[model samples]
Target: MDYEFGMLAWSMAGHDKDKLYVIIKTEGEYVYLSDGRLKPVERPKKKKWKHIQVRKTIPEELCSLTEETIKNEEIRKVIRRFSNV
Candidate 1:
């Protein structure tokens, strides 16, 4: 499955198993993920495609953020807020 930017996904393997994360970037079989906490935007987690379970894709406008506008605090807040809903 093709994963879009800002898509929600769950870790299926490794030490961070079962943790929720947002897809920040993707390339080939790897994807850059951030839970906004453990995996902040500046230090995203690199996981394999087959190791994640995609939950759903949030609205593009809501998740779509330019590199210049992407802040760590905002990313944390958004992930926390949406997950709590």
Candidate 2:
């Protein structure tokens, strides 16, 4: 299944038909800078982010599937060995 990610910037209401909640830096990790350490807060009822940006997607080749496959194979081998022991 295809999954998507976005930052919930703010909540808005009673706007034009084309506008709704503001979602920013969608679909990938984005570098966000804050003046101080920010923690999760209650959802605001206003539109804080006016910028709609798309984040860069990393190439799948960099995340080598070979390592994961090897790990899974090793796990299966260990499970089979213990099962027969």
Write one digit per residue (lDDT tens) for candidate 1, span 18-38: 777888888999999887787
| lDDT against the true structure, each candidate | 0.78, 0.25
Model 2 residue 36 CA deviation (Å) reads 42
Which candidate gets the maximum TM-score versus the true structure? 1
Please give the distance, in angstroms, between residue 51's alpha carbon in candidate 1 and its true position after superposition: 0.4
Q: What TM-score would you give candidate 1 relative to the actual structure?
A: 0.80
Per-residue lDDT of 45 in model 1: 92
Top candidate (lDDT):
1
TM-score of each: 0.80, 0.19
Candidate 1: C-alpha RMSD to true structure equals 2.1
Model 2 global lDDT (CA atoms, 0 to 1):
0.25
